[model samples]
Target: MNIAVLIKSVVATDESVTVSGGEIEDTEAKRVINPYDEYGLEEALRWKESFGGTVTVIGAGADRAAEALRTALAMGADEALLIRVDERSVDEHATAKLIASAISQRRFEVAWAGHMSVDNGAGQVAIRVAELLGWPHAGAVVACELTDDGKLLVTRDAEGDSEDWELTLPAMLTAQQGLNEPRYPALAGIMKAKRKPLTELTPELLGVDLAGEEASPRTERLGCETPPARPAGRKLAGTAKEQAAELLGLLRGEAQALKGRG
Candidate 1:
């Protein structure tokens, strides 16, 4: 019943961001666990509590990213492992490969992670790792439980509804928003995390060939531009029927213009 949770360090969602030289400036921005990943970590911790097993938190990031793993330990994870990478040069492809390689050496029955990263919004890492491991996978999971027969009973969001799935051991799952409420680290747990095991490893240590051209970043950002400011709102005046007619005309005109542009 051992479980592993893939963690990511991202700029705080509420913090202001600046795009410089095709990358968001994060040197000074406060870093935290990806919100969705926190849900997955919480679910893993709960599963460990219920099933009596170890829970390990793993991440691929620069050295500073160890703070996020320490935070996970503070929240009750049994241990932490960091797959070190250069923050500036690494992309999702390299990250997934590095993580998959690191995970291949670990012994566990389940792996958990967020559906996507807040900064990149690319929800491909967990699925790619699952594929690399040749394991069954489910994504955007909102609810899950371990049944008596050693199977996982899971419910995942499919658009507005949910899809139920049952899987055997060694499965990967990505947490959605409604999965569960994440717990904050208490004083005791925080102190305990200071002493909990936190190991760091490089891609080469995992037998990943990052020096090869194939391991290089597959995509690059040219630049980032702020979205154009929205147009100001206007108030419609006149009798109810007159206002309705005017609004309908405006809607029709707007739709027609957009259609023409398309």
Candidate 2:
């Protein structure tokens, strides 16, 4: 019943975003655990309480990522591991590689992660990790239960409806909202986190190479800027038929503008 939960450090939702050098400049923003991952972490902790086991939070990224692990430790994770990398140009594929390599060294009955990160919103890491590990994975999971025959049943959100999925041990689940309300780190928990076991790792130590990433990033960010302001609404100043004609003309103009761009 050893549980693995993947956590990530991200800029707080309320923080202002700044773009610099064709990338998000988040060095100065307050860092916190990604909100979506909190649901998965809470579910993992709940499962740990129901079935006796250790919950290990794993993360890979810049140095600030360790902070997210420590926060998870305070929230009742038994241990944590961080694969620290200095690169800023990492894409979902490269991150999946690093994380999957690290997870391969651990033994666990199940793994959990957020369906997507707030910043990236790719919703691809957990599925990719499951592929790398050769395990079945369910995304947008909202409910989980253990069957009598030693199987796990999970409810997945498909748009507005849900579908139940049964998985064997060593499966993966990406938690969606409504899974569970995560507990905050209390004063005592915060104190205990200082003594919890935490391991920091490197790519080379894990037999993964992240060097020369600038030459071949799976995804590229050419530039970042705010979208132009939206125009105000226009009121048609005419009778019913006249207004209809004006609206039709406006739509035709917009279509022609789109055609010109294409």
Candidate 3:
């Protein structure tokens, strides 16, 4: 089983987000492997351990993104490939194109990625890559097994429910949160990862045309603003009857306001 896992480097969730000139100033932000992508990496590692094959971690981003690939390496992936792209030119479609092009250069039995990237929250890249590769794809997979016949049986999250699917080899799957607990990089593994092969590539190297007018992003960002600050909670005072009355009053007020707007 030659497995490929997709990973992303993202701004740390706890770090403060600073926006400058319609873009997030993330250059100085603490970076880490995207939380959801970690599950995909772990699943790939598990599959490799069971079937005995090399697991290659693939990523597309600026130079700093290599650190995330290294982290995946430390977590047990055999190798890492980074597709360097201009930060401004990287949208979901462009990213998928670059990743698909890079993967096309190698032989892989299966591919895995997070259901969505935390930074952009655009859950379309992995499936789009599958489309570009003309391979079947399953999203939000929580469990996967290789059958005796070499087909992959996967259980995936379907909103509040679950769905099971059987796909042939060479398919792609996006991992959900319940897939598996991600393993931390051990000290020895961390040291070993430094010695592991980490290759970097560009769109030119991959024979991808990123310069044409058709390469422009289909979607445009108009602007970005921080969410409004949450209002302070109001504490009710007095007996249950008084609180109930207060709640009803508040509801009535909201209803009247909505009616006025209508």
Candidate 4:
């Protein structure tokens, strides 16, 4: 079996967020693989381990995105592909199209990606890829098990509920959180990754214009401003009933303030 995992480079979670010029200012930020995508990559590697197959890690973004792909290789991907794009403003459809165009000719039995990205969280790229490939897809998958006949048993977390699904070969899947504990790259794996085959391709070569993003969402940001700091909590050193009454009065006062009557 040949499996492909979609990986994305993202700013570190602990980084202080700042918006400028209608985009996040991350020029100096550290980059790494999306944590959720790491889970998907781990799942793909596990399948490769059990089934004895090749795992290809694919990423679409700036050249810096190869960092994420290298992380995948370190964890045990057979190969890596980097779709280098220079621009920063890319929509979900264009991103999906670029990736699909890259893998149109490659024969892969399964394709998997994270359910969403930490930065965008659009959750549309995997669906669009499945649509482009004319294959069925399941999103929010938390677990996966392969049968002897190559059938995939997948599980998804649905808020307070969980559901299981069976999918045949040649399917696209978006992995959700809780899929599996992602394995850390050991020294041997890291050394092996240095010798792994990695290929870089440009979007233009794929006959896709990743620059033009056509779709726009209903909401647009006029400007980004930091939220006002919350006021310090008030001290109510009194009886329990008196403290309760004070809290009630505060809530009512906030409501009246919104109504221009406080």
For 108-193, candidate 4 gives per-residue lDDT tens digits of: 99999999889878888888988898887888998788888978898887776889999887889988888889898889989999
RMSD of 3: 2.5
Give Cα distance to truth, residue 70, candidate 3, Å.
Answer: 0.8
Counting clashing residue pairs in each candidate, in order, gives 0, 0, 0, 1
Clashing pairs in 4: 142-179
Give the higher-TM-score candidate: 2 or 4: 2
**Residue 243 in candidate 3, Cα distance off native in Å:** 7.9
Give the clashing residue pairs of candidate 1, or none: none
Across 104-148, the per-residue lDDT of candidate 1 in tens digits comes to 898999999998889889998899889889989999999998888
What lDDT would candidate 1 get against the real structure? 0.89
> Could you tell me which 10 consecutive residues in candidate 3 have the lowest summed lDDT?
253-262
How would you order the candidates by TM-score, starting with the best?
Answer: 2, 3, 1, 4
Model 3 scores what on Cα lDDT? Answer: 0.88
| Error at 19, model 2, angstroms | 2.4
Better of 2 and 3 by lDDT: 3
